[model samples]
Target: MAGNKSFFETLVMEEGGNVTFGDGSKRNVVGKGTISVPELPSLSNALFVDGLKANLISISHLSDEGYSVLFSKDYCSILKPDGQTLLKGMRSSDNCYCLEASIVSNHVSMDEQIELWHERLGHMNFRDLRTLGKFNCVRGLPKLGKKANGICGPCQQGKQTKSMHKKGKYLTTKEPLELLHMDLMGPMQTESLGGKRYIFVCVDDFSRFTWTYFLREKSETFDKFKMLCNKIKNEMNSNIKSIKRIRSDHGREFENATFETFCNGLGISHEFSAPRTPQQNGVVERKNMVLQEMARVMLLNNNVPRNLWAKAINTACYIGNRVFLRPSTRNTSYELWKGKRPNVSYFHTFGSKCYILNDRDQLGKFDAKSDEGIFIGYALNSRAYRVFNLKTLSVMESSNVVFDDTRLKSNDHEEEVIFSDVSPLEEVVVSPNVGTSNVNNDDTQPIDRVPLLDSKEPAPWVRKLHDKEDIIGEVNESVKTRRQLANLISYTCYTSQIEPKNVEEALNDEFLVLAIQEELNQFERNEVWTLVPRPKTTNVIGTKWIFRNKSDEDGNIVRNKARLVAQRVLSN
Candidate 1:
């Protein structure tokens, strides 16, 4: 009995003496099963019989025998119908049976339990399930399986090693201008019409209102900044308690001695962002971007020249202050500063073709009526408009102008003409002797007049003596000695005509000689000479003199041009 009980314990089965068979018949089953038993049913066969007896099924080994047998409740009842029958069967010669009674129970299969476990919990991998199973508390619980979907490649590629971000604490101020952001933007490639290539941007921390100034050079920053500050102070009528702090990048223009001295003298604090870190001065940097973008779009759309970008940016800032709403307040900076709505009716299209009526002109019948100009931008510090004249290639200013936004650009059309015509007048000419005659007729002889000569001699001889005497006197004055007189007489005898000889002699005269020499020297100083040596066999052309007097606009003599001519000789 002890051995049989041990077998029942190992197999997890209940033991009974007799059991009722199927068909309501009973059978006496036997005493305890023997130990070291042979020819017993296999685990599969035992499970088959147990399953037939009860809806709840399990499999186990009854003994070491390979043969399988089936037993049901009818068999157990037939073996032991009553207590006396069971006792009789236990004493029987062939009573070697141990009966097991069928019991009703509910259970689940291993596969169904696994599916149910996965449904209750989420999907998990085999490795994860094995790890969870190692916990003795959760051992024997069903495991979950994972879906085959994998990791994202793009996400892994995009992930980079990054340092932890340090968030800076916000600095608070009590007043509008307490803290300000200042930056200088460029030495732009194109120069503005006013010759400005750089711009200064300043922003108020509290209201986020921005002010910008176009500058020809960075050196103008201090002067323009002082002007801005003075204007603000005057307009607001509020003494700046303190500048408090000024933030900027470490540009040399902003960090120079001049700027430092100015700030120190004013007792204003200055702060510099870390090297190469623009985000530290993000407010002004963002303002620069906004202004630049607005200017770029305006220029591109209007086909305005790139040089006008600075003016466009200034205008952009002006319009932005009036139209752009504050991020926190939902009100324009203009409204906040001026306490009124901005009037946009005064705005005009930039770079549009315009015609300006010349109101200043008191026009004659033949004068041009109007001037054509291209609108460049609005004038600063005034209500007038700025325009560019293609004819003059200069900018002009006017307030009364007619604009045609849809005007077509014409290749033949000229720019505005500045008319400068005056009416012609007649002049009165007087001979040199007329003044003397007039004074004589009034019976008042002037002290400078010479006595009149008498004409009593005959016409021919008298003219001859007068000409001869004049010639003799001129010769006497010109000749310094007898030798020069002899040379002059010899030259006059050799030439064919006395007129030509006399003219040549006059050109060779001292005053004419000096004037020609001076002109040649002047030309040499002006670098108008080119020297070239003549070839031995070639005929060199002779040079000659040409005279011209250069004059000023008022007809006054300024310079004389004595040109030397060279004529090439043609070989026969």
Candidate 2:
């Protein structure tokens, strides 16, 4: 992080927070953006931390980004992934590595300035940034000098194995929302904390702008699609634009009657790729892979729980829209869709340790003012950060949050303490504790085993009856008549509390519907089964509803219970 605001050319003021230095003094981090220093690699996501006497560099962060930090008696060197020396630092008298270079000056040359913008745009190739500058396609881009050439360590690490997808023969859509590609990916091995197992992704062909929705079941795809339609309608009506066509693979979630009817109602043509061919819907197919890969990397790099996969994916989509450029237009999706350059100065590393103000409850003067949390994503409806609170074990959105992205996660206490914290959300199989850290508390004591008692004789209640007379006094017509009368009265009392036998009958009754919903909720809570497309060769099993009315000892109906049972006859 840079100390001075003048160090950043594109700083945003919205998401400022306090940063604590090693000396225990706190300074305000007012914004974040790219920082350029002559002869040094341009820094992306640099925080504008105010009131520091000297700029600090994190060797740990450079190592994580595929840079090698070498230290010796007199100096230290920062090398790129390919072992090329990028920067050298001298050991100070106080035994700290200080960089030889200084902060960027006001009279820096245009070439260095263009190089800085290159890093700002997610290390985009200079040719594209220059193209945008030349054509005036994107706002806030300055004129470019001759193509700035450099080896970007991050781009090399991220895209080394990736090859560009070949373009289609036909001309792409010319207007926003003219054509949309949508697809569904998942039923992930792990269900998210929100019980979401599927991601519905839609990408506009013209702008490459994408929208993602997390769904508990694939059956919800239609509902999310309808919601996106309403959102797009409101945003596009002023521009005289309407959805012209939408494309997806032949998944039942997309090819169903509900989706067809909705699209037809809006005068939108729905197109389907041929069965077994995913490339035809490659726009969203590729997007699904990219989003998942990015989210997976972020989660794994930060040692975050897999149950927050939905949050990571949501954040990935949010960042991709702002940072990624369309190859055809050399403009970011945000610029093309919203007609303005996106301000990403508020971006933070996903899963960074943060503190959220504990203002929800009254606190004493001596109490800590903030709760430790893990930064997850940005809230869509408000200007707040979404955080997973450690103490409450719940996810919340808060405007008053400070980030400590530079700190390393301590393996000593965090893993053991929070391992149980995630269990209530889902059954996660964590590795057994194997570290050598000594137990510090006297409360931990070894359990003493108790011996079992042996007995051969059976209890009186265990004996079986040999004859009917042993249990009851007698069996006669008078006793049978009494029993019949009791049963008849019970049946008459419950005549108004009938139970449904089938789904059709259950749907007609409000009480039965509520009972069914409760049962479904239980299934979801337990993560019984993920909803998925039916295989062609496998016979589909049918289900039946078994409903019952529970009565108290007074014969008053107490509760309506419903169970969804599979028909075994169909399985045969």
Candidate 3:
């Protein structure tokens, strides 16, 4: 045996040459040589042999060489050789080969297999697809053959409706009092200071300037309009032109003869909106909103009392005129009207606790230097400021004032001590240790030892009553008989129960009836008894008189009370 074998051979080789049998399972060969082997077809070629059995079931080859004979199977064979069957199974169509002579007779290629893979995988562009063989997971995926555009569902849902009024159509006049819009608002539950329950507001259509006046009754609308018309006319020095059109709701106040006549007299055209239509006078109506909002904010910010909201509202309007910009103009109403920048240096904090100099009081060594007050508002007609004095219980005007801006909170003032000019000795003193002292005692009596007179006993006459008896009798005779008799009898019998005949008579009896009369005059001067008659439909109670006597320490009568009482009536 040779050490090397031919390319087409099934020779077994070892380190040395040795001959191996056809069945080499039990033999070992060490040499290589060219062996007699049948030629096999190339993988690229097909083969056809003459005189071969037809309907061959399979073909096989052995070894790594170009060819080696192996068992073949016929269609009707009982069993095929295991080695031959295995070799035939391993020979795939893609890997098979045949010689050039066989290729010239018959040929085949793997074009079908290559096409099958392309069909199953789909021809996706390698660059488009990720390197890992999957679609790229990006934020925005491009549509096939289209440019990428990100989707935003939220943006679509959040789209808003178009504005009603576009740019450039809003009111844009620059001068104050040139164009005015007027509207009346409310039959409010609360009546303002001055007992006003309704508000009539006028807004300058150009500058967005606002002026509000309170009315106790809506009938005052014409008066307010007239006042506004005169003010604007005098201040602007312009005639009541077409710009002086007065816009208002179809209220009785706006429709009444007084309003129409006033408008006609001033040559001002009246523009009345339809009934229940507020938007027709939209300018002033909208201004009312602006004013009310500002008023509310000011009241809340300064912690001002709600009852003083009228002042707060007025102050809000003043500040709004100075600060708020016109919708169409960069300048404010104050700047437009005054033709100069407004000075805000005089603007003090509203509702701040302040001390107003009491100009009404003549300064005394013991008098307070200033009166406690709350800064309410600025005076519109004057340069002074308005303050609500807690001590005086009145609204007062003062230009001279000191304010504590940090103290905007209310109900924090110290309680005031009210003093009277009367001496402390004048006050009635009740002492438990000492028995009630007599109001009347002889001046010559010893201070400690004299016995005080009983209150029930009548003291000695301080003056001669007999001297006046003749004059009293003459005056008593001039009156009607029944009245004179009633007076004389009532006086004599009820002297202890009521007041004496007169102050002089009471004084003659050592009584201070003059002092009591002086106090009574004070109550009358204060109008404590000016009662207006209630309406018939009103469920008013009937009043009655109750008499009482005021007494001193020793129980001596000092004054008398004639009070009225009422009896409740059933409500409807």
Instruction: Please report the candidate that would top TM-score against the real structure.
Output: 2
- lDDT minimum window of 10 residues, candidate 2: 442-451
**Could you give the candidate ranking by lDDT, starting with the highest?**
2, 1, 3
lDDT of 3 by residue, 482-546 (tens): 44433443233223344544344443321133234334445675676667877886766555334
State the lDDT of candidate 1 residue by residue for 358-431, as single tens digits: 55659688565556656555555455666654333346666766665542322322233211221221121211
**290-340: candidate 2 lDDT, tens digit per residue:** 787666666554545455677767777876787677765567888888877
Would you estimate the TM-scores of all the predictions? 0.40, 0.50, 0.42
lDDT of 2: 0.66
Candidate 3 C-alpha error for residue 268, in Å: 2.3
- Cα shift from native, residue 564, model 1 (Å): 26
Candidate 1 TM-score to native: 0.40
* Cα-based lDDT for every prediction: 0.48, 0.66, 0.46
